[model samples]
Target chain A: MRKGFRTVSGLTAALAVTAGVGVTTAFAATTTTSVDFQTHGFPTVAAQAAIPAGQGATIKAGDATVTIPTGTFSDPVEFELLEGPLSSFAANAPSGQTPVFDFAFKVVDQKTGAIVMKFQKPVMFSLTNTDVNANSMYYNIAPTGTYTLNPVKATISGDTLQHAIAGAPVGWVVTSPATSVAQTTSPITGLPFADWLFVGAALMIGGGVLIAVRRKVS
Target chain B: MRFAGRSRKQLLRSLLLVGGGALMIAGALEIGRIPLAYLRVARAEQTTVSKPLVKVQIVAPPPAKVVSYSVNALYPPAAAPGHQPVTGSLMGRLEIPKLGISAPVTQGTALSILAVSVGHLSSSVLPGEVGTTVLAAHDVTYFHHIDELAPGDTLTVRTSQGVFTYKVVSHQVISVGTNVPNTPYPSLVLETCYPLDALQLVNQRYVVRAVLVASHLTPSSAANQ
Candidate 1:
């Protein structure tokens, strides 16, 4: 009995060590800055701000928000957010996909008068509209002046579609697949094979008439 | 003789009418059945089997620093760098112990590749990497029973680089056009055609998302080399 008890204790200790290690490993992988910010949507021509390099800002306009993290810029930048039709913000939108919303997030160097296309760190861009979901994808304007599918997936939480990007000062559009109008019925009629059935009936009737006529002659 | 001929004619007309009517009825029923089958299949597409949770012991890898809420951290770049596998080349084997699934994983999702084994999207990152690894197979084949898997079920992939184990986080039946998001951490995505028993192709897919929970490097592997 004493030997059995020792074995049990040893097992317990081993299990405890394993559990502790698992917890520590998971915690380490998840360490991140737990910074949170809130903003409400409002109608504006554009939300532009001269944000300092050391501080971040969350700019919101017309159901869209751009959250620039701290240290995203090395110098004071003039950031502008515009939300409107795709034509207003982008040179061309994707042809076959239905556009959900269009937003252009741009940042400019206050000193050099140059557009800041890339950031030092990633920034969060989200569109909060009831229509957006996993089915919706993000397309950004390319250098060739056409929108292309951003390889990154947009994470969907409830009604919002969000993605993290390191490059900006470009037009982004969220679009869903155009609903396909499938041909549920045949071209001739609502009833499938209607014409074929009529043809079969006609042939059968003709066959019966011929058989009856032959029988009478015989 | 005339009366006999008249009787024969009458019999033939009756037979013709009855047979024609029966044929028309059958055709109508078939026409109606096709649409109903489509409706039934749509419902089946939405259905997912819920199974009892299975507990399995896992030895997780040593902690590696992971960034949270970033594009590079979550999604791998579209143009993956490295010596890409030739089309139809075997990448590795994927296994789900709970479901007793062990299938060869091929490099691409082309018809020829999926015909024999599971296909890994060439654009996605490799297994055990920080980004999402997407694997897909036909529902009629290797992944037929994946719907039976519950959350927390373990999935493992054995490659030359390492043995990566993932835990099931969620299952979703999404439209074919819907994009499965790249998770914030290392993840595995299994996809199959939806409505497992449908005779015709469907516009939906069954997606299983799993997060990497444990992994160990293969000894003297190419990664080590």
Candidate 2:
């Protein structure tokens, strides 16, 4: 479902309005969209600006900046940029990827009332790095129904993650792709020794109870 | 001392108590074996031996579109073309020659799967791939002796994809959430609950990292024969 980008306070009302618009109307519009950032426990900072077809616009959210080049979109669009903490997606992260920063970008067609997934030309997106790994790589959460980290070729120039993208509606994550494994959960819940102790206790108690019952019957 | 003077109930009760006590002691001994084994072989000593870097030859599989949040949804289908594996499906067998461990490795790290066999973390690259392939098991079972695996020891993995040999590079016992350091080479990481003999849940994990030293792909191995 597509909803016009709004501030954190108005996010709920906007989503409610979109839900009321029904499926047919929503599909008739562009289907390209990102999950509501606030809904997913992401930081509540979003910026939106309308860029007419054949024109370019620059939008900034927090320390991140996005530049849409002229003729990048064949249609007039409203650019949306949202920023949040990378740790929010820790559980969903691809193994071995330690994410330090996160961003979500979406493009909505102004006239068609739909989100834009592809671009006529590429756009430049950059973020002023904060505690980002120097050896980190750019990855986008592929909407393949799972949280797949697709490496995006990017360069770091003195505390910045700058990269070019062919489309919007991407969940951009910067992660250090080192480490063969990160064991987050404890693996041993059932120990053989513990099981044995329980078994022995049960046997001893059962035997003692039977001996007492026999003496009473006699 | 006289069995003729003892009643049937008394005899039965004595047998049960003695039998249960013996069984409990046996269980304690089983748990004691883990620490004893560790003492015989020292905790992984950091060796400074410089081994030649082995070239990674196996081409990593193309990025599969499988991404899942649930434990059951994590695994890719077992050697099936264009299919995702079901959780607990057999992926391969892991062998540690030094420790005499040969255990089946399953796909996902579900408790049910780890209780019986080594479980592969779903998000890692498969064995012999360019990235790290992570496998884990319960310390009570396949990984009880992992602490005895010192640097320079060799371990082999046989999979449908190929046969791979990795040399142990380092071992560390870290807090549960700390990440295993990234390596520039193709690596394999084995993890189990720490303190191997802990009778209850622990907050640390024992990790063993190894680099790929040799590999024999299925096609090449078959052709050589």
Candidate 3:
């Protein structure tokens, strides 16, 4: 009975340490920022055709009440896009694919079930563009009530996707208020594909060694 | 292999060690799906202001007839019509039946997702409408696919409004600022990097001018008849 008790205690301690380390590593990666209108490039409507009445959007998250802003523009035909939270937008992003985060969407008004606008090209958003490599979501709400989102975490290296997609100096600079955060059901944890690999390797080696030593003693 | 003459205590240790290790490794692998964003462009996207030029002809449909609402509430805060949200994006998917180039299109040019990629312009390019509806697309992403396009390529724009079909009457690459002179026919103008991926002074701007062919404007048709 003592031996069984000893083994169970030892295993419990080991498991706690391992899981704690994983959580700590994850906390170090997720960064958050409080972005205002200026941080997001305020749009200017040079010219636009008049659009009649349209539905707007409202985002409800945590304690923050997020609403769309009326941007500055020169044209009376200006259109307004009220975006929801980045976390809520979805896209067609597949891992291990070149040029991740395809932003293609049809304009829909939940009330009408009507398709107002359709995008022929894919607006590509990359999570690996800044420091957080994982699936990240960004929302762009058009005045016509169309929501286009890039909804996947992908491996984006170098400026190929950035330059090719933006057609100009391109890439998103993420500003997180918290340098890092605890994992809150987010798809990605802190660290890269290599970090976990190292932990696994260590566990395997330690387990093997402990097993070997026990046999010898026996 | 070490199962020989083992005491119960020794056996317990072995099991805990081996079993715990396997579980942790598998869990670690499952956690490896996240991506990292470390690389940056270092420099911002380049935008060169062109010198003021001459007045040009306007062919696009008379600015769409929108019912004017004087109510202050009609225009909500953070609302900019035709304004595209700023995010890391390039090519938008395009399907112009007239243009054989039915694939992903980059956002700079007006034709495909230009407004979505660039500004608030999606509502402007109505297919089969009376006036010329201009659409610009990046020459590189979807346009590179156009390098493979010939004169006879048919272009199509499938929007929430409906599917618009056009035929490429003429295609040319001009300077970035060269706007067509004539009020011109109702058409779709697609722009992109002139020669494949030419980073040089936009070496040339490829313009595909397609006149309206047919449209699936059923809602209006149903409303009229």
Best by DockQ: 2
Predicted complex 2: CAPRI docking category: incorrect
Per-model DockQ: 0.03, 0.10, 0.03
Please, what is the TM-score per model?
Answer: 0.37, 0.43, 0.28
The 0-to-1 C-alpha lDDT of every candidate, in the order given, reads 0.56, 0.58, 0.32
Which rank order by DockQ, best down to worst?
2, 3, 1
lDDT of 1 at B60: 39
Model 1: per-residue lDDT, tens digit, A1-218? 12223332232223211112111001111111110100111112356788997679998654568788899888898887754423222225454466556655556677776556556667788777645666888765432345666656678887788877665423567876544212211011011234444555665565565555545643
The deviation in Å at residue B218 for candidate 2 is 2.2
Tens-digit lDDT string for candidate 3 (B10-55): 6677676677667556655544422211111101111111212111
For the predicted complex of model 2, DockQ is 0.10
lDDT of 3 by residue, A1-218 (tens): 11223332232223211112111001111111211221222222211233223422232221112222232111122122222212111122122211212122112323343322211222232222222233333322222223333222222343212211111011122211112111111111112234555665676666666656656654
**Candidate maximizing TM-score:** 2
Error of 2 at A109 (Å): 62
Report, for candidate 1, the interface RMSD: 13.8
lDDT of 3: 0.32
Better of 1 and 3 by lDDT: 1
Worst 10 residues of 3 chain A by lDDT: A21-30
Model 3: residues with Cα > 4 Å off, grouped in runs? A1-218, B1-93, B96-125, B181-184, B200-203, B220-225
Instruction: Please tell me which model should have the higher DockQ, number 2 or number 3.
Output: 2
In CAPRI terms, model 1 is classed as incorrect
User: A176 in model 1: Cα distance from truth in Å?
Assistant: 21
